[model samples]
Target chain A: MKKHIAVVSGDGIGPDIVREALKVLFAVGAKFGHTFTTSSYLAGGAALDAVGIPLPEETLDGCRNSDSVLLGAVGGPKWDTLASNLRPEKALLGLRGGLGLFCNLRPAILYKQLSDACPLKAEIIGEGLDLMVVRELTGGIYFGERGRTDDAAFDTMAYTVGEIERIVRKAFEIAQKRSKRLCSVDKANILNTSQLWREVVKRVQGDYPDVEVSHLYVDNAAMQLVRNPRQFDVIVTENMFGDILSDEASQITGSIGMLPSASLREDSYGMYEPIHGSAPDIAGKDLANPIATILSVAMMLRYSFGLQAEADCIESAVSKVLDNGYRTADIHTPGMKKIGTNDMGSLIAQSL
Target chain B: MKKHIAVVSGDGIGPDIVREALKVLFAVGAKFGHTFTTSSYLAGGAALDAVGIPLPEETLDGCRNSDSVLLGAVGGPKWDTLASNLRPEKALLGLRGGLGLFCNLRPAILYKQLSDACPLKAEIIGEGLDLMVVRELTGGIYFGERGRTDDAAFDTMAYTVGEIERIVRKAFEIAQKRSKRLCSVDKANILNTSQLWREVVKRVQGDYPDVEVSHLYVDNAAMQLVRNPRQFDVIVTENMFGDILSDEASQITGSIGMLPSASLREDSYGMYEPIHGSAPDIAGKDLANPIATILSVAMMLRYSFGLQAEADCIESAVSKVLDNGYRTADIHTPGMKKIGTNDMGSLIAQSL
Candidate 1:
């Protein structure tokens, strides 16, 4: 396979981590008879500092031309005082919106070797956790009409039939790929947005006849995620609710540095990234963890480029490295050796 | 002091549990130099069966006439098919709305003895979880404009400055009574409703000069709740977020059956109940936990009747019974005796 992957080493430790992710990708390619062409681009705070804009035209062009895109963490306190439209995080919203990345897949998986690092009990973290959250990427309250006045403020959570249908269809398809169990979460009892969401999801359910479908109130789903996450397979929800729940789900996996996510449009191209933010506090300190970014590359290969064998190779290498107790500062266990960012990335590449 | 308490033994195990709560109230009354006048009312499914409506005219009359109201669990599957206006859950909402109960207080407290039952690790669970979530009960998305259309649907998350001011003031007052720490949670980074919410909360902070105030985006706050719950003292948020977070917080106490909540108006009158709904599956089976309902009666005494000593007596009895390993079916641990609902309620009252 020959693939062109656009790389956005965003801000803070992004540059260093992306270097390691690229290194791993090259090493995997050399060993697996695959060829990857890498192209670097500007994004987030770094882009703003260089060109007075977060997502530069050249950067979007680079991603649009690639087979897949890999982004490191973006945004930080440095951009906190910037105007809302100019802030580094706005770049993320722009890229997702511009690319029509409607399906955001955030899988919260607990690696058996890292179970001890989880905040949850051993019993609750039993066996291993595997659940994918399919969040509608570009719609809902996140991009809905919002306004404020001197006395009152409003934000509309709006969903069109077409929007709901596509997201629910993607959810059922993901369920078909996994355990064939789908849970559509909403607040149907109260919100009409939710009522329509439920109705549309039910309509989509008929198409995926082999998949088992269930519905849960968003509140109850949040509670159940903590109470027993094992019960879920493929969970789908609206953008804002998914934003919160997906983050909560990330925490269950022990370290945000170990989680990766994919934002995709229907064109078989996607953006992959670690589900972490720019850690300015530890930036330039060589303390960042690169596993999440490396794992993101793995997802790019499998989901975007359709190089399944190469992706599995990278995933297994990550598992083996964890099995051998190689730990980064964030996921360090009592007896595990804590290595710096580059060293951890090098170890995973070596394992690959 | 003489206090008149209106007790609404709702449905399912409501009557059985209220029998014990009343006994505890009487026991506390006997210990303190207080006299109590009790009145009973019908509500929930029981009320529908007896009076043809969930909240009958007589029940509302009783609630209006009493100093405070103590309600047992309400709603179950039996009323699932009832007309929306006559559903048992509506009775609970009607009571809150009719009484102008705008501030809903749900305290998440983890008894030292019950910490082992929590899903999160002991270190994350921390010493004792004692944060009070003061949720705005009557505003925000919960009561916002909602509807469905042929091709789309929407719900407005709306908030008025006056509404936020009152709720924030109530939260600050509650924080002043607690550890003097308050966290105002919202999605100010994304939603206009939250931006106004943040601004209003900040403006209201001037009134509470002595209390420490902090702002957290709701997504970050949700993650923080699981990562480090002990960091919070008093959390205030809009309705929908509060409903979800409060339930999540309650689960950290091990069993949902152990959490009590109160919906109050500024006049000091409130409707008290456990956060758990009626368990129709075990409704008549005597398997429900009554400690939460019993503890709610304690809150009614303290916050409504101003009988602090009586409330203390009830609380100490609950603590003492739990200290002696009195486990209700819902919170049963290995080797702990699983007592029936009535037995557990009676045991706590007897301890009082």
Candidate 2:
């Protein structure tokens, strides 16, 4: 097997953590009899420094030509004063729009070893937490028509049947592969877009009858996430609601440093990254956590390269590393063996 | 002072709980040197059974004519199969629209005695949770124009300067009387309406110089609620965001049956009720908790009638009753004296 990957070590502590991720990826390739090639491209603040643009055309083209993209965190306080469109964060928008990545998969999994970090009580977080937030990335009010006047302002929340169908189909497929349960979140009682969302989800469910499906209003869904998170498997929602819920779900795990996300197009092409932000204050320090980025490579293997066994092997190595009492600075408990980012990544690679 | 109250004990446990609340109200009136009058109206499934409509013309008129309104819970499975417009819950919409109650106040207060009921870890719920959610009810996406075509659907989220100003002023006034810290949540970076909201809130801040103000995106706000709820004193947001956040806040408290809410208009007219739903299964049994409805009366005394001392008396009495080991079925613990709904209400009334 062979794969070519585009890598973006954007800014701040990004380069430090991303370096460790590639080491783990190389270890996976060596263990599994596969060829893995990578191309480094500048983006975000790194690109702004070199070319005065957050996202260069060459970088976008490199990502487009690759099978998948692996990204470190982007943006820092240094670029915070830049104009909105020219800021380092805009590079994310440019890449998503240019690559046509519309479906966002945020996995909020709380490993039992780190359950002590979760904000929820032990009773409510029974048997550990594993839920996927399937967020519609390209549609809804974020991309809707908006305008402001002297006295008023408005934003449109619009959805086409095609938009709803694609995401719903993706969610159902993922649910079928996992626990075979999907909960579609919407505000159908108030919004027209929500009604259309429900209709399309129902239409898509017919094609995947084995998956149990349910519906909840966005308000109720938010409450349920805090009350009994164990009930959910895959939760699909619109752009803004998803934006709110996925963050809430991530926070409750109390280990945002351990979570990774994948944004995909209709095809297998996708971009994987850690959900945590770049810590500029710790840039170039060996203290930043690298487990999230390493796990992101695992997601890339499963979702983009159709390498489930390799992905599972990477995940197992991560769990085994934790079991043997290895810890990065962010997730370190007093009893655990604390190690630097480089050592943490090297240990996982050795286990692989 | 004399006041006339319109009482709507709508469905299921509605009648049972409202009776206990009224008993508490009369006790307050007897001790506070005030005169009170009351009129009962049918407005929910009960109204549907009698007058063939969930909200009859007379009930709306009666509530409009009164100085203020006190309502019990509404809706049940019996009314669940009805058409959307004819459902028992529509009566709530009718009352709010008819009375012009545009500001919804949801208070998530977890009593220290009931801290065990909270879903968050004991360390996270330090000092107990008491935060107010001031939600804009009549504007934003819920009241905006919506339409659906065969292939697409859309809903407009619109806000006017006047609308935002009124809600901001009300929130500011409420904050002035409470902790004086206000957290305004919006998605200004994306939506035009949110941009206007921030602008209007900034303009309104000139009149509220004594109140410390801060802003957060809705997603971050949701995460903060679970991570550190005690940090918030008062939170104001758009209708949809409010709807989602208030519910989430209520659930984290884990004593939903003990929370109360209020809906107010510009003038001093308002409607007060419990945040919990009508538990049809526990309707006629003495198991329902009346603390929320009784607390609603306390809110009415303070907000609608400007009787702060009287409101404080009611609140203190309710707390004192719990201190004396009286517990309703919903909030009962092993060593506490468990009592029926009527007995719990009587104990609070006697304490007042």
Candidate 3:
């Protein structure tokens, strides 16, 4: 198999982490007998520095032309003073919008090796926590019409049947592949958008009768996430509710630095990245964790490339490394051997 | 001082819990040398049963005429099949709107005696969690324009300058009274209403210079609530965000059964109630937890009647009862002396 990968190593430790991820990806390709070609694209603060914009047209074109996109992290204090639209973070919004990435998959998994970092009690965590938050990225309040007048300001939270249907269907499909349980969360009792969301999800439920479906008010869902996170499998919700709930879910894991996320379009094309921001303070120090970025490569393989076995191998490598007490600075314990970012990536690749 | 109190003992364990709270209130009044006159009003499921509406005109008038109102839990499964407007839950909304209660104060306090009930690990719940969420209750998306078309549905999240001002002022004043630290939660980076909310809060900060203020996006705030709940003092946000966050905050305490909330208007007139619902299963079984309702009475005295000392006495007395290992069935643990609702309330009253 031959694949073209677009690499957007944005800023600070982004380049360092992406470099390690690329090494691991190349190692996987070599071991699995796959041909992978990569093209570099300037984006985020890097683009703003090289060019005048956060997301150059050439960079977006490069990503669109590629089979899949691999991003590290974006934004830092250096670009914080820029206008909102010109800020380094705008590159992320621009790419997602330009690529039509509607579904964002954020998996919050508390590995048993890192269970000591979990904020929840042992009883609440049960046998470790692993849940995916399927967030609708393109629609809902985030993209709604918003304006401010002299005395008042308003934002319209609107959703169409098509928007809700697609996201719910994607969530159902993901659930079908996982535990066959999906919980669609919305404030159906109050918001008209949520009511319609529920209606659309219920309508879509007929297509996948094998997957069990449940509905919860957003508020109750937030509470349930903290009270019993282990009960959830796949949580689907609108953009705003998803934003809040996913962040809440990630925090409970107590290992935010090790989480990976995937933003996918209608097709198999997706952009995979680590959930953590660029650590400018530790940039070039080899102190950053590369496991998240490596796992992101694994997600790209499974979701975008359809290489399930390859993805599983990479994931198992990660688990095995952690089981062997190989820790990065972010997840280091007293007895664990603390390895550099490059070393950690190499360790996982070697294990594979 | 002579005060008029409207008591709304709605449904299920509502009447029982209110009875216990009344006992504590009267005890406080007797000890503080304050004269209190009470009037009973029907609302929620009880009103729906007696009259055709969940919130009757007579009940609204009674609540309006009183200096303050004390309410137990409302709504039960019996009224679940009623029309949207006729539902027992609608009574709470109707009262808030009719009474012009704009600011809702939800205190998520994890009592030291009940630390074992907290879902978070010992380190995360340092010194016990105690924070207040000041939510703008009568406005924002819940009361804003909402409609469902054939293909799309929308809800308008709008906030006027005056609306934001009043709520921010209320929150700041509360923060001044408590920890003097206010964290304003909003999606300012995304939504117009939140942007306006942030502006109004910053402007209001000038009036309360002594109070420390910080801002967090709603998503980050949700994460921080789980990561380190002790970092927050007073979290002020719009209605929908508040609804989700306060519930999340309460769940971390692991004792939702013992939380109280207050809804206030411009003046000292406020309505207080337990955050829990009407548990119809235990309606007249003497198994209800009255601590939340009793705490609501404490809030009523502090906010409405301005009886600080009296409120302190009531709070301390309730704490003493818990310290003595007396618990209601809902919050009872092993080795704790579980008492009936009436007995628990009487014990706190006697201590007062």
Candidate 4:
């Protein structure tokens, strides 16, 4: 097997963590008889410093040519003074839009090793929490037409049937691969957009009869996540709801540093990244955790390259390290052995 | 002092719980030497069953004439088959709109007596959770202009400067009375409506210097609610965000039966109710919890009548009862004495 990934180690702790994740990727490639090649691309503050732009033309082109894009993170206080459009964070918006990635897959997995950190009680969480929030990223309120008048300001949440259909189909396909349970969350009782969203979901659901489908109003869905997270497997919703819910799902797991996300298109091409932000304060320090970025590589393998066994191997290796009482500074407890960024990456790679 | 209340004991357990709450209200009046008068009005399924209408003209007129309104609960399976506009739940929307109830106050209070019921770990909750969500009920997405085309469906989220000012003022006034901490939740970075909302929140803060003010993106706010709920006091947001957050806050408290809400307009006049729904299955039986309704009475006294002593007395009495291990079936534990709705209300009234 041969794979080429566009690597954008954006800024701050991005370079450091992405380095460790790539080491693990190389380890997976060697063990599984696969050739994984990566091309470095400038984005975020790094590109802002190098070429005076947040996202260079070369960067987007490189990602478009590659099988998948692996990103670390994008923003910091250093670029806070820059104009909104010229800021480091704009790289993310540009990439997602330019690449035509319509849906975002964010899996919230509560590791048993880090279960003590979870906000939820033991009984509520039961065994462990593992759920994916399939967010329709390209459209919804965030991308809607908005304007402000003298007395009033307005934002329009408009959704075409085509937009809803694609995301619903993607969610159903993803559910078919996982636990086969799909919960479509919307405020159909109120919003016209959600009504259309619900209609499209129901229309697309007929094709995937094997998948168990259900509907929850956004309010009830938020309550259910806090009350009983174990009841969910795959939660699909529009952009804004997904943004709120996915973040909530991550918080309940109690470890934001360990989560990875993939922004996918209709095809297999996707952009993989750690959901956490770039910590400029700990930029050059070895204090940053690399597990999220490493797990992102696993997502790229599983979702983008269709390398299930290889992905499983990488995931298990990371889990095994945690099970063996290894810890990064952020996720470290008193009893666990704390290791630096490089050491943790080496340990995971050697284990793989 | 004399107060007139419009009592709309709508349907199902509505009558049973309202009866108990009225008993406690009478007790409060008896102890304080105040004249309290309640006019029983028909609404919801009860109104529909009697006159084939969810909310009658007489009911609306009675409520408008009263100092305050106390509602039990509304809607059941009996009215589920009714036309959308004629359904029992339409009474709520009608009441909120008809009364010009622009702002909704939902208090999410975690009782130490039922701390075990809370879904969060003990460490996260700290002392206990007590926060109010001041939601702009009459504006934003719920009341926004919405329409559907053949290919696309659209809903407009529009906010006037006056609308944001009113809600922000209400929330600040609420915070002034409480711990004096206000958190305005919005996605100002993206939506134009939210940008105006944030500006109004900022402008309103100038009038209240004693209160500590802050802002949070809705996604981060959702995460923070699950992560550390103790950090907030009064969270004010637009209607849609409020609907989602207040429900999440209530679920985290783990006893939905104990929560109460208040909807208010420009004047001191308000409509109060339990946040829970009509438990039709327990209509004839003495199985409903009366505390939420009783609490709603306390809110009416505090907000509408400005009878702080009466409110405090009612709250303390309820707490004393719960502290003494009295519980309704909904909140009953193994060792706690589970009493019927009538007995629980009688006990709280006796304590006062």
Candidate 5:
């Protein structure tokens, strides 16, 4: 099989970690008797510095031509002084909007080795935490009409029935693939947006008879995520609420550095990236964790390239490395051998 | 001092908890040399049943004439099938809106003896968790324009300059009186409402010279609350965001049954209530926890009646009872004796 993957080595430690993901990808390709061609492109603060645009047209073209797009984390304080419109974070957000990617799948899985590190009790954390959060990427409060006046300011939490139905349908499809359980989270008890959300979700649920559907107020859902994360299978929510809930869900795994996300449209190709931001404070240093970016590569393989075996290989290799007591600063557990950026990445690749 | 309190024992566990809170209130009044008179009114499902209106005109008149109002939980499944406008929860929400109760303060405090009940590690949970969540009760998505069409729906997240200023000022004022630290949580990185929120908070900081101000995105704030809840002193956010975040914050202390909230307007007396909802399933069994309602009574004394000693007495009594390991179903910590609702209430009053 031949696959072309576009890589965006975004900023700070993005390049270093991305290198390891590529190595792991190459190893998987070889093991599975498959060939993968990688193309690298500039984005985020680095692109702004090099080519004067956070997301250059060349980068978009490269991604559109590829089987999948893998991104390292973006933005740093160095670009903080940039105009809000030209800031590095916008590049990532803009790409999602520009690509018409409406479904963001963020899987929050707690590994057995990292269970003790979670704030929740061992009993509450359960054996395996596997929940996919299907966040509506292009709609809701994030892209709503927003502005500030001298006396007032406002942002809309708008949702189209078409948008809600599509995202809900996507979530139901994913649930069909997984545990066949879906929980739609909204603030229906208070907000009008949520009331409409509930109505649309109910209508959408009728289409998926196999999927078990439940509704939770956002506040209760947030509490339940920490109290018993194992209870959830697939959580679908609006953009801003999903943005907040998904991050909190990542924390349940006891490692933000291990979480990866993918934003996709109806097409097979998608943008994959680690959940963490560019830590400018630790940029030049070797302290940034690379597992998140590496895991993202695994997602790119499974979700985009349809190389499940190769994706499993990358995932298993990372798990084995962690099982061997390797640690990065962000996810350091007791007695784990603390390793730097290149060393950890090398260990993962070596395991692969 | 002499005071009259409008007591609205709502529905479900409303009457049970209100009875306990009144016992403690009477004890506090006697201990502090204050004269207290309570007029019990019907609201919520019960009021709707009796007067055919959730918030009766007489009840509103009672609240306006009284020095303070203490509400037990509202709503039940019996009334859930009623019209949306006639439902029980609408009454509580109606009172807040009608009374112009803008500042909603929910304090998440972990008792010393109950610290063992926290799911997080003792080192992370630390000695005590006390943080007041100041939510703008009157504005944002709650009261914003909302509508649903055949294919789309919208809910505005609007904030006026005056609303933001007042809420931020209230938070800083509360912070100055406590740990001298305030955290303003918003989605500033994404929403225009939050962007204006940040600017308003900065401008308001000048007025509170002694307090330190910190800003965090709502997502990061949610993670930090779980990661290290002890780091925060006070958190001020918009209405809907606060609704979710405060609930999450309350869960960190192990049970929603232990948290209380106070909603106040500038010129009027405040309304105090427990953060927990009516547990319709356990309404008649006398199994619901009443500590939150009792604590809410304490808040009514302090914030509305200016009865500091009376408030302190009620708080101390509740803590002493918890120290004695009298458990309710909600806070069923290990090895703790689970007692019935009335017994726990009696124990708290006995401690007083």
Candidate 6:
């Protein structure tokens, strides 16, 4: 198989972590007998430094021409003073919009080796939690019309049948691959948009007859996430609820530094990245964790490249490294052998 | 001090719990040399059963004539089949609207004796969790205009300067009484209403110069609640955000049966109730936990009746009862003295 990968190593530790991820990817390519070509594109603060824009048109074109995009973390205090539209984070929004990415997949997996870091009690965690949050990335209140008058301000939360149908179908498909359980959360009892969301979810359930579906009010859903996170398989919600819930779910795992995320459009074209932000403080210090970025390459293999075996191999290598007691600075324990970013990457690649 | 209280014990365990709370209230009245007049009103499922409507005009009239209202849980499976307008929960909504109650106070308190029930790690819950959520109840998406087209549905989340000012002032006053720190939660970076909310909160801060104010986005706030709940003193947000966050905060305590809430209007006039619902399964079986209702009585005394010492006495008595290992069926554990609703209430009142 042959694939073209666009790499956007944005700023700070972003370049370092992305380098490690590329090392692991190349190792996987060699072992799995695949030909992979990579193109480095300037974006975020890196682009702003070279050019006067956060997201250069040339970079977006490069990503568009590639099979899939792999992004390192973006933004830091260096670009915080810029205008909102010109800020480093705007590059992310620009890419999502330009690529038509509508679904964000955030998986919160509490590894057995890291169970001690979980905020929840052992009894409540109950054999560890591994659930995916399928968030509708490009719609809902975030994209809705908003304005302010002299005395009042308003924001519209609107949803169309088409938007709901696609996200629901994606969630169901994801659920079908996992535990066959999909919990669709919304404030149906109160919001008209949520009522329509529920209606469309039920309509889409017919397409995936094997997937079991359930609905919970947003408030109750938030409570349930803390009360029994183990009960969820694939939880899906609109943009704002997902933003809130996905963050909550990630925090409960107590290992944000080790999590990977994917934002995808309708096709297999997706951008995978680590959920953590670029640590400018640790930049060039080789102290950053690259596991999240490395695991993101695994997600790209499974979701974008459709290489299940290759994805499994990368994941297994990560587990093997952890089993051998190798740890990055962020997740290092007392008895663990703490390694720098490059060593962690090389170790996982060597395991592969 | 003379006080007129309107008691509406709705359905299921509502009557049982309200009776116990009234028992405690009367005991306080007798011990504190206060003249307390009580009138029982029909509302919720009781009103629906008696007059085929959830909120009878007479009940609203009774609440209006009284200084404050004390309500038990409302709704049950029996009334689930009723029309939306006639549902038992409608009674509470109607009272809030008719009485012009715009501020909701939900306190998530983790008792030291009940700390074992909390789901969060001890470090995260240091010194026991005690935070208040001051929610703007009467406005925002819940009351905003909502409608559906053939292919799309939308709900408006709007907030007026007056609305934001009143809630912020109420929160500041409450914060002034407690920690003097108020954290206003909003999606200010995205939504226009939240931007206006943040603006209003800042404008109101000048009025309360002694109170410290901070801001947090709703998503980060949700994560922070699970990560470090102790960092919050009083959190204020719009209706929808509050509805979700307050529930999450309460669940962290792992003692929903022991939580009480207050809905207040402009003045000291307010309606106090337990945050729990009518447990149809436990109705009339003497299995209900009366602590939440009794605590609601304590809130009423503090917020409405201006009887701080009396409220303190009631709170102290409840804590003393818990310290003595007297547990209701809801919060019961091995080796604890398990008691029924009536006995638990009597014990608390006796301690008072």
B-chain TM-scores per prediction: 0.95, 0.98, 0.99, 0.99, 0.96, 0.98
Q: Comparing candidate 1 with candidate 2, which one achieves the higher TM-score?
A: 2
- The segments of candidate 5 whose C-alpha lies over 4 angstroms from its true place after superposition are A284-287, B333-335
> Could you tell me which residue pairs clash in candidate 4?
none
Q: Predict model 3's lDDT versus the native.
A: 0.93
lDDT of 6 by residue, A325-350 (tens): 99998999999999999999999999
Q: How far off is residue A340 in model 4, in Å?
A: 1.7
> lDDT of model 6 at residue A295?
91
Instruction: Pick the lDDT winner.
Output: 4
lDDT for each residue of candidate 4 in B1-352, tens digit (9 for 90 to 100): 9989999999999999999999999999999999999999999999999999999999999999999999999999999999888899999999999999999999999999889999999999988999999999999988989999887999999999999999899999999999999999999868999989998988889999999999999999999999999999999999999999999999999999999999999989999999999999998689999999999999999999999999999999999999999999999999999999989989999999
Candidate 6 residue-wise lDDT, B146-170, digit = tens: 8999899999998999999999999
lDDT of 3 by residue, B1-352 (tens): 9998999999999999999999998888898889888999999889988987999999999999999999987888888998897899989989999999999999999999999989999988888988999999988988889888999999999999999999999999999999999999998877889989998988889999999999999999999999999999999999999999999999989999889999999999999999998899998888999999999999999998888999999889989999999998888899999999889989999999
Give the per-residue lDDT of model 1 (tens digit) for A185-211.
999988898989998988878899999
Please provide, for model 3 over A1-352, each residue's C-alpha lDDT reduced to its tens digit, 9 standing for 90 to 100: 8999999999989999999899889999999999999999999899999998999999999999999999988889999888778989889989999999999999999999999999999999989999999999999888988888988999989999999998899999999999999999999988899989999988889999999999999999999999899889999999999999999999999999889999999999999999998999999999999888999999999999999999999999999999999999999989999999989988998999
* Better by TM-score, candidate 5 or 3: 3
lDDT, residue B164, model 4? 94
- Runs of candidate 4 exceeding 4 Å displacement: none
Which 10-residue window in model 2 chain B sums to the lowest lDDT? Answer: B78-87
Query: Model 6, which residues run further than 4 Å from truth?
Result: B81-83
Best by TM-score: 3
TM-score of chain A of each: 0.98, 0.99, 0.98, 0.98, 0.95, 0.99
Give model 4's DockQ, 2 decimals.
0.89
**Interface RMSD (Cα, Å) for model 2:** 0.7
User: lDDT for every model?
Assistant: 0.87, 0.94, 0.93, 0.95, 0.86, 0.93
Question: Model 3, B163: alpha-carbon shift in Å?
Answer: 0.7
lDDT (tens digit, per residue) of candidate 5 on B1-352: 8889899999999888888888888877787788889898889999988999899989888888888899998998888888778888888888898888899999998887777667666777777788899999989988888887777778888998899998888888889889999999998878888888899998888888899989998999989988888889999999988988998888888767888899988854899999998887898788989999999988888787767777888889888887777899887778888998899888988888
Task: Give me the iRMSD of candidate 5, please.
Answer: 1.2
